[model samples]
Target: MQLDRIDYALLDALRKNARLPNKTLAEKVGVAPSTALERVRRLRESGMIQGYHAEIDPQALGIGLQAMISVRLERHARTDVAAFDTYLKTLPEVLSFWHVAGGNDFLVHVAVRDSQRLRDFALDAFTTRKEVAHIETNLIFSFQRNARLPAPPRD
Candidate 1:
């Protein structure tokens, strides 16, 4: 959907903090509470706002280590890829996974309790899979997320 200045302003305010009260949000975007409510509803219905999420610290959940595992598959058939994707979804350690181009077919992000768990996770998750041709694991020291997205160019 084409977004006007009000839409962009509402998105910017929400992106920074989704918990902002409706009154505060309306104030920030220079709109009346009811208009802000209706506009946000429209945005959601249009799928502009997919969902809101809370950022949680991995360490707080007893996750001491996190790593990205690059996986190269031996086969590129649809069935093989789909099966692998389904398998990744079942893994509790997997934070997220991306199917992408390049040398690797997939990038799997995971979190575990310690280095041993990380090693075990890699071996069990990737090395055992027959379709997996190669796997590379990289430790993540720190992570950060951008507060807001760049504004989309106006038509």
Candidate 2:
């Protein structure tokens, strides 16, 4: 579905705050509340708008450190990759992971209590896994997110 200027405006407003009231959203997007509601519904149906979520502080949840680990797999077979992916998902420390095309098969982001826990997690999680050929971990001192997405491509 083609998105017009109004759609783009609505998307921008929603990205900054998904909890915005329908009336507030409509006002920001310069449309009637009913129109804004319908447009948002259409966006969801088209899969343009995914699910909304809250951004919680990891520190508050006892996460004192975060790390990004690069993993090289021993085997690149579909079964081996799938199994490792499944195991990663089961780990509560795992925030997210990317299966990428590069020197590493996967880049995993994890949150832990401290450096000790981070080391233990790496040894227990990746080092012990036979599928993992090699692994490297880097401490994350800070992180940031850009709320607004770039403008969509023109037809």
Candidate 3:
């Protein structure tokens, strides 16, 4: 869908707080509640609004540390590569994983209670796999999210 100013306004409002009711959203975007609801529906149907989720405090949930594991696998075959990707998803500590072109084949974001668990994950989960050639784990001191894009300059 081609987004007009109103669509951008609605998206910005939703990004700020997805829990906002249609009534409040409409008020913020200067539209009727029904219109806001329809627009939201259309946005979802068009795949512009992927999904809504709450931002939780991992620390409060007993997760004290975050780490990124850069994994380089020896596997060159497609089947083996796919199997590794699927296996990564089953690991509880894995928050996200990316397949990228670099010295590392995969970059994995993980969260654990402490450094010991991180070490355990690297040794037990990754090193045990014969296909995994090299693994580097880095402790994350700070993490930030760019939740929304800045609006285009006014014409």
lDDT of 1 by residue, 35-97 (tens): 999999999999999999988888999998999999999999988899999999999999999
Cα lDDT tens digits, model 3, 45-139, are 99999999989778999999999999998976787679789999999888999988889889999999999988987899999987789999888
In Å, residue 46's CA in model 1 sits off its true spot by 1.4
True-structure RMSD, every candidate = 1.1, 1.0, 2.1
How are the candidates ranked when ordered by TM-score, highest leading? 2, 1, 3
User: Runs in model 1 with CA error above 4 Å?
Assistant: none
Q: Per the 3 Å backbone cut-off, how many clashing residue pairs does candidate 1 have?
A: 0
Give per-candidate clash totals.
0, 0, 0
Worst 10 residues of 1 by lDDT: 146-155
Q: Please name the candidate that would achieve the greatest TM-score relative to the true structure.
A: 2
Error of 2 at 133 (Å): 0.3
Error of 1 at 23 (Å): 0.7
For candidate 2, list the clashing residue pairs, or say none.
none
lDDT of 3: 0.90
The whole-model C-alpha lDDT of candidate 2 against the native structure comes to 0.95
Q: On a 0 to 1 TM-score scale, where does candidate 1 land against the true structure?
A: 0.95
Question: Model 3, residue 47: displacement in angstroms?
Answer: 1.9
